[model samples]
Target chain A: MAVRVQREAFDIGAEIDRLRAGRTSVGAVASFMGVMRDFNDGSGVQSMVLEHYPGMTERALESIVAEAGERWPLIDTLVVHRVGELRPSDPIVLVVTLSAHREAALAACAFIMDFLKTRAPFWKKERTPAGERWVEARASDDRAADRWQEGDGA
Target chain B: METAHGSVRVLYFARLREAFGTSGETMDLAPGLCTVADLRERLALRGGVWAEELAGSRVVRFAVNQTLCPPAHALSAGDEIAVFPPVTGG
Candidate 1:
């Protein structure tokens, strides 16, 4: 398992290749990439700033990946979350899960993302047409995270 | 016995930092001030923004020693406490 919280842009292809290297046992890789959108909540977003709790953020990501490991037969898991200023279309986060079967890889990928959405300490503030505003936590995100608690795998 | 006093490192993030105008501060806690809620009430003594931002209905989250915790969680001397708005990340 590997987790990175950085300001530098990440190359998704390179990261996947690194995980695939020397791993003939891996049959599936599931990945998710989150990008900054040009608009949100009826406003045009100019840019975004992500703030995190530094040490706590890394610990939280590690814990989330660890939880996924316990639930799935994951060969490898990687999470890369970017911090600081970013523009529209910029990659904001990435999650990659490798497993012998598609089911484990796919489920673990979604699980990691679901937990990370609400449990992580990162916060986003968008520079919109009106002014800069902190993005509020969506109710849908809470519901997404809550569903995992009701079941064993998902 | 003397009334005990201890200091905690309080951190503010996101909007809290923007409102408080500082990233963190060292607060001296009085004895018997145990839980996160107690500390918040004490901090609220500053009134105005402090009281308004930390109002009961506001969406605030707390972390004690870098771990997310509830308001009733006990606090300890030399602990690192963080106060921030609800997280919005993916």
Candidate 2:
């Protein structure tokens, strides 16, 4: 597993190759990429600064991936998150690749991303034309993360 | 010496910094402060409306020893505590 908070953007193609690097047993790879949207909570966002509880962020993500791995027999997993200032359309997060099979890879990939969305201790402060404000946590994210508790993926 | 005589360190993040007007601080725990909640009460004793914001039922997050924890987490000497609002980053 890989987790980072940086200003750099990740290349999905290179990441997949690296995950599959030196491995022949992998059959399928599933990935998720999150981007900064132009709008949040009805506010027209111009730029956003991402802040995280540095030590806690890593632990939270590792636990999330570990939970996903326990539910699915994934070959490998990667999570990358961007920190510092970013603009709309810039990549904000990336979750990539798992599997001995497509179903396991796909399901685990989705599950990991969903879990990270809600459980991770990262915050976004959006800068709009009017002023800066912290983005609100969405109920949809909570519901998405909840699906795992019901064992809906399995 | 038991080496337990130093002040308690409080760390802040995200919106909590805005609310507290500072990111991190160290305060002598005194004789009565023992747990995370007690420390919070002492923080409230600092007076003014800032105390009200710190002690209010806002959705603040907590961590002790770099571990995400609750207000009930028992704290010992030299423990690092962090406070922030509910996270909204992906």
Candidate 3:
């Protein structure tokens, strides 16, 4: 498992290849990439700045990935989050989970994304046409994270 | 009981940093200030922007020693405290 928070953009194909190489036990790799949008909250966004607590952000992300490891049968996981200034279409975050089965890989990928959305300490401020404003946490994200607590018994 | 007096390094982020005009400050904890909530109330005594930003209805979150903590969490000398708005990351 690995977690990286950096300003430099990463090559997605290279990241995937690294996971696939020298790993014959891995049967599936599920991934998700989050991108900056051109608009949010009904306003046009020109750019965005992401801020995070350096030491704390890494610890929090490691804990999130560890939690996924405890709950799922996984082979590996990778999380990369970008910081500093970014523009629309810029990738903001990436999650990749590997497992012997597609179900565990897919479910763990979604679980990591859901937990990252709410549990991570990063914050975003968008330069909108109106003005720069800090983005607010959405209730939908809380709801999504809450579902995990309910378990897959449903 | 002996009254406890201590200090903590308080850090701010995002909007809080913009509003406070600084990244962080070392605060001397007043006597009997034993909880995160107590520290928040003491800071709010600064009034104006501090009062408004930390109002009870606000969506501010607190972290003690780099861990997300509730208002009732206890405080300690030399701890690193972080106060900021709710997280909005992917």
The pairs that clash in candidate 3 are none
Kindly report which residue stretches of model 1 are placed more than 4 angstroms away from their true locations once superposed: A152-154, B1-4
The true-versus-predicted C-alpha distance at residue B46 of model 2, in Å, is: 3.0
The segments of candidate 3 whose C-alpha lies over 4 angstroms from its true place after superposition are A151-154
List DockQ for all candidates: 0.82, 0.64, 0.83
**Could you tell me how far off, in angstroms, the CA of residue A106 lies in candidate 2 after the best superposition?**
2.4
Output the better candidate (2/3) by DockQ.
Answer: 3
TM-score of chain A of each: 0.97, 0.93, 0.96
lDDT of 1 by residue, A1-154 (tens): 9999999999999999998899999999999999999999988999999999999999999999999999999999999999999999999999999999999999999999999998889999999889999998898998988998895563
lDDT of 1: 0.91
Candidate 3: what lDDT? 0.91
Error of 2 at A89 (Å): 0.5
Best by DockQ: 3
Interface RMSD of 3: 0.7
